[model samples]
Target: MTQIIRTSADLRDRVAAWKRSGILVGVVPTMGALHDGHMSLVREARKQSDRVIVTIFVNPMQFNNASDLDKYPRDEAHDLAMLEAEGVDVLFAPGVNEVYPDGFATKVSVSGISEPLEGAFRPGHFDGVATVVSKLFGMTQAGRAFFGEKDWQQLQVVRRLVEDLNIPIRIIGCPTIREPDGLAMSSRNVRLSEAERAQAPALHRIMTAAAEQIRAGAPIETALEQAKAEILAAGFHDIEYLEVRSVEGLRPMETFSEPGRMLVAAYLGDVRLIDNIAV
Candidate 1:
């Protein structure tokens, strides 16, 4: 039975009152289609703070394709039920008008790290993520915020933004949740037809294999090529990008760096899926 705060003013008022009463708040930001991955974040937030705030905003600014934004799933009633069951204390579900009333005149963009891989695929995507996240951090005044490690690069960008902007909230990255078949749990998974869902696990499987190859002293270029071959052979129509980068700064690597990650994005039919595995 968590209260839903749909406006910035209401969120600030509640958070300010909570602060006066010494209540520590934790936040989980999402784009409305709540799944097990999102619930995991809420549960983690519940463990660390007196109250948990879950924001459901599709964030139009983050989409490079207008159709992608239009096609994003949204079910407020179902999402609210899931949040309530997970013990979330507040649901900040705002309309686009409320969150970006000025038609997005300004945005937050990070240099260096924001211009590669996912950034290259969807231009200005991180800018939208950073801007909306900054607004959420300010509105909720969260003592801590929870994010999934599935979007590892995006998590890093947020971490940098928090540090550079001197935001007081502690950002915690939760582990990536996955299906029994090993496919990373995602809201977009719903868009996959039955056969596509069965084939989607190949992305994770390939990344896992690539990580093993790197650990076994295989050449980075050869391992990546093998991984790409594996995915392509598994019926992935388009391989957007598959790369191994240093975990610290997400820079591309020519050799295995001991501790890094394999990042992959592919299109199965029309649905775009992304996944990563640590090396």
Candidate 2:
């Protein structure tokens, strides 16, 4: 059974005991909607550390749109069951108040890497991510952290955050898990309507093909334009962005580079889906 921790003090005490015993703790931070993608991170954590902690906090600060925040899928009972089954040592599902007390006034913001793509579309988002992630690191005091590569830009931002701040925790990025149909698994997928869900896998298919084209010597802009057109015709409401960027600095790349990642963000009905792959 996974111990559910809801307060900072209690989590600190528990981590202290583990540290005293020379146990290396690992943490998987999440937003309370556990899918196979999240489970993959937990499994990696279990394999890499003596103990594992999975945090489920639907951070209010990260959502630029209020409705999106309210609509974010959250089922603590189900999430806890999944963690317990994975042998997670703790679930730090803190309430908003617990994470951001009334007097809270600090924010962690990473510049440059965070100013494009998702950041450009969703304003002030990474500030919230950085702040909460830093808080989780301080609260859990884990030796390592796990994140999915599906949010490629996010992984980069968190990496930059850890390095810039000199945070002690090591950030481990796992591969993006996909469904049988090739659509990347995300907590927000539950909100996709039947028809929309049926058409959603095109995002991955189209991006994969485009990445291959770039690798095969096709022009980057030409491939992106074709992909955007295909995505729109595939029943997506809108294509916010579809481009290749440097894997490390996340700089927009017009020509194929040695290490690049192709990322996309499209809307299906009211749900916004993001996916990425190596180019």
Q: Which candidate is the best by TM-score?
A: 2
1-279: candidate 2 lDDT, tens digit per residue: 899999999999999999999999999999988999999999999999999999999999999999999999989999999988999999998898999999999999999999999999999999999999999999999999999998888899999999999999999999999999999999999999999999999999998899889999999999999999999999996788888988889888988867898888889999999999889
lDDT of 2: 0.93
Candidate 2's displacement at residue 198, Å, is 0.6
Worst 10 residues of 2 by lDDT: 250-259
Q: Clash pairs of candidate 2?
A: none
lDDT of 1 by residue, 174-213 (tens): 9999999999999999999999999999889888988888
Candidate 1: residue 198 lDDT (0-100): 90
* Residue 220 lDDT (model 2): 97
Clashes of each: 0, 0
Instruction: Tell me, by lDDT, which candidate is best.
Output: 2
Q: After superposition, how far is residue 248 of candidate 1 from its true place, in Å?
A: 2.3
